[model samples]
Target: MAKQKTAFVCTECGSDYRKWQGQCNDCGTWNTLSEVRLGSSGGSGAASARSSALSGRRGGFAGAVPESRLLDDIDCEDVARFTSGTGEFDRVLGGGLVPGSAILVGGSPGAGKSTLLLQTLCHLARTMPCLYVTGEESLQQVAMRARRLGLPTDQLRLMSETHLESMLAALDEHRPRVVVIDSIQVVHSDEIASAPGSVSQVRECAAALTRFAKQSGTVLLLVGHVTKDGSLAGPKVLEHMIDCSILLEGSDDSRFRTLRGQKNRFGAVNELGIFAMTDGGLREVRNPSAIFLDRSDEVAAGSAVMVVWEGTRPLLVEIQALVDESQLGNPRRVAVGLEQNRLAMLLAVLHRHGGLQVGDQDVFANVVGGVKVLETSADLALLMAIVSSFRDRVLPRDMVIFGEVGLSGEIRPVPSGQERLAEAAKHGFRRALVPKANAPKHAIPGMQVIPVGKLGEALDALEQ
Candidate 1:
């Protein structure tokens, strides 16, 4: 019998090394290498058989050889998609779930990853075959939750299993149109020598399942665990294997959850979905702007409203800034749901162009309702909010602002500027401060459009 070989692997980047080292040379991460046992040189019969099954080969070429064709000559028909029974969920998946595609959903515990899938599967099972396999929870527990939620449990098939071979066999037998693996971390392959959730085990199991999905034309939904730092647990290669990767984000205490797509082959990766946790289950937020713009009637000095384009629509969110005299030698610059470095750079621009200085003050900024503002369109709103707070002046509550401020004090226009302004106007915003290039040709019915080319001009308009 040939001796089994051992190799070191980096948990961060999934790079294999011959031996363990103090740091991973590939990812530049320290102390992330772990030892993994490789299959013997001779290879066990079971391992070979499993490998053949996964690859759909029987010791030789299994199908006819392929031929290359011109890119334009190839068929370019649109792929069919079926709704996931939830509009928000479907929106994040480009339009709907496509056949023969694998999607990985990841989130921290209690973030409603399982709840959302369960609800969607239950509704979808009525139209087509669906299977729900759980490796973490018992069948009784899942049934109890389904009963409590008043879901249509009769159509959805449930199975409790962890062995990869058995799960694959069940998939073959049931032949469901849609299959949900409660989680990939808990599923272990019989051929692997390592424990479940290990780097090797996760890689092999996911590869096998994805291959099956591709061949069988099944919509595969995988639930993935997240590390403490809020990234998907397991090898980074797992993300590369799937067609789409989405993250469900929210604190356990918060009722609102945000689903953001990190990667997608069929849809836009920048799409954002909003859901509210309730006794029934996760319900979609049709009008997210209203929920995110919920503010008190009394006007505040540091509060400002901004229109941000998210995915296919526009969102109205409130931006707040507080500037106070520094109590310590080094003034603290903190940002919640916003970038810290951006706040510093925006401050410098304000000082140079707008003639406002708060270098000695502690600056804190936040986006209301926990919505992360990634676009530079919020720059003008942030600057205006900071200025209002420093001067103890209250801006008009009906005013909306969205534009990008350059280092040279010029205001840059954002994409879909007219749509953003229209959305704000729909929400009853009377005044809009935007970039000159983004200004509409004709005036809106109830809104006043103020277009500014430089930072100094914006400050002048604010005074008026």
Candidate 2:
């Protein structure tokens, strides 16, 4: 029998080596190298067969192109964007999908990643023909999901196959305008003798499909699986191969989903798309501040309003906190999505400088609407709410509090204070505890805007 051909492959970067190495040469990840069979023909045969025309007399290798020549400008309008049928999805992608762009969508199981894509295709197929390829589930499964979505279009075609070589051949024959792969994990290639979802197969399949999409000038949407820790699965090169990558995130309750762009060659990265989970599908939430506010007849203590900036948008969220005596040596400062150590530090700041007896308290904080807050503008809100909750006092229902409490007991003006106030007012907040520096030159009627320079002043106003 002919000897089997194999090589050591780095699971992180997909770099192949003849001998095992302690660390990946490409990504510098340690202990990621594993042995993988390159099949009977080896990878060289596969590479030659795959790119025979490019490596021909044209000199397909990159060594031929000068570094300066590689930096040439590309057409902007021509490479603009493609409409995905969902307005929010379009917004997050910087208006639309780029022509011939390969985008990866990753999320947890049942996080509505697949549903969102299928809905998008159904909308696009109304004008353009689309093909959906699935390797893990059958065509019937896709059909069932479509029916549940009340979308059964004739232009929407589905294929169930794990063999990427066969899938590529079919794609060449069909030539659809848009292509969507249900997932990349289960897809494999015969060129590499490895189990499906392994590093080699995933890298090979992704490279092949990415090449095909770019060459054919077709837009491809790939649904990827996220690891348990929430990182995108597959080789690191997998993220590099695509033109765009969007991460869909939400709480386990399925009440909301947030689409954030980590990489976007078509537009700006860090763009955000918010969606509310409903029985129908993911509906984009345009003004999240309104949805997050809870206006009632009465105000309660230990409650405060905060502002957080997500990408380019500023949103107002309610912060609720409770404080009590600590039962253990280490007080518990628990935060759902926010950093726990940050909360502990804030508490310490309150005790040391703000004249708060919270050293022995078991304090907890929550950012409403199930979204995480990374901004410290909510610091004052958190402090006030915790104190109120401990005193069992009711805060004014129409009052909104937001500022950064300094160690010297001064109230620091938050960045984008005007915008935050506008959002709070739009949400029907009448009273606001704002930073003294952020106070407008001329006061507007109807709402009471109280500007304070110190945390003690704000506390006195709250007491009144």
Candidate 3:
């Protein structure tokens, strides 16, 4: 009989312990320690055999040792990427998908995650054999959708079964260049002894697929559903198993879907792909600045353009604010698409540092086009918008502002200001409001760069 040994593992962080504990030391979670089987019922010889088998069937013990030694001496060459048809996908992938890479694409429901993957696979399958295995949708449903999308289905295959072993067998026999699992939550592993979508099953199924992808040199894309809180559902280990992770998010109206890279071993993490949903499919927005800047022929008050940086791309965005006298005991402060805490801090700075009395005013601030503005480069624009609304004065045409505002009511220079100015210049912005310290720092011609030291200077400049 094999020796029986037990251990405790935290289900949250995968922390291990020798004995059962009340709480996990890593995450400080209560009651997360669960019994884990270390060894069972006297199988030392079998364990050795299984280890030998994993090391790949040794013709004999001597052969096994030689094979393992040979593996250590072998040097691997870097694999080249398989170019997908979509430029945005290729860019996010740092060119294109690599053979043997396991990719996890996660998103909210109806965020067009499936549509994007389907479109890419459709193009890939026209030349090479590809398989899509789904447990959520039926065969007829996928076929109908594919037909509507005008997908070339000569080499594309679909399977509705989700059993891991059967799926592996199909991959082995079919030898497909690409395999996509519609979702990992719906797949189950009998060895796990847990329901599908549970922590155990998700990890098990994903690990199996990842192993298969690496060994076969096949590209595997797994679609993962997000929880209500916008987190990928499954064990954290699933993320560690995959080579890349892409997150898809959209606004409430679902007009725009942004694909941001959460993890990419081959590229920068901050790179984003913008797409607008259309009747045909999601169309890539090449120039993102045009979508966020809404300017009329006539100059308008309460609207200011800011040069914001998202990753390496610089975009000009419009900010609008409205100030109204409050009748209630507490003024209603609403900030849409911008951080509420940041807005509150800015309001306090405007009052204490800029000599603006907004305590009795209801201020409503919004970043146009439903884009989240996290960079401090947008502060100058927001301040301009609020001041313009307060004075009911229109800002000059073809003017943009981007500078970080300090609590001392001073404008501070922002990083990548020169790059932002160049992008704004490319978009026909003739004038830019920046920090006083940034004077002579940027060299973009065809634009007048005005440096402002304080909010008073900015307000005065706007008046002129």
| Most TM-score-accurate candidate | 1
Model 1 residue runs over 4 Å out of place are: 3-7, 36-38, 43-66
Candidate 2 lDDT over residue span 1-464, tens digit each:
44677788776676878999798877899998877665566567667776865765232212133234343484434555668877789877878877677899999887889888888888888888788887777888888878877885677878888888898898999988889888889988877778988877877788788878877778888889998999888777788878899999987875889898889887777777889888777888877777777544466667777777666677777888877788999888888757787788777777776677877778888877777777778777887888789878877877888888777778898888777777777777899888899887776566789999987787788889
Q: Give residue 393's lDDT in candidate 2 (0 to 100).
A: 86
How well does model 3 score by local distance difference test? 0.81
**Cα lDDT listed for each candidate:** 0.92, 0.80, 0.81
Q: Give lDDT tens digits, candidate 3, residues 249-340.
A: 89767688878787888777756778898876777888888988756777768888898877667878888899888998998889987888
Pairs clashing in candidate 3? 1-42, 2-41, 2-42, 2-43, 3-42
Candidate 2 overall lDDT versus native: 0.80
| Candidates sorted on TM-score, descending | 1, 3, 2
Clashes of 2: 5
C-alpha TM-scores of all predictions: 0.94, 0.85, 0.86
lDDT for model 1 comes to 0.92
- Candidate 1 on 1-464: residue-level lDDT in tens? 77777888787888889988999888899988877777666657578888987986653211333567899998888899999988999999999999999999999999999999999999999999999999999999999989988899999999999999999999999999999999999999878898999988888899889988887889999999999999899878899889999999998778999999999999998799999999998999999999988999888899999999888889999999999999999899999988989999999999988888898999999999999989999999999999999999998999999999999999999999999999999999999999999999998999999999999999899899
Candidate 1, residue 403: how far the Cα is off, in Å: 0.9
For model 3 the TM-score comes to 0.86
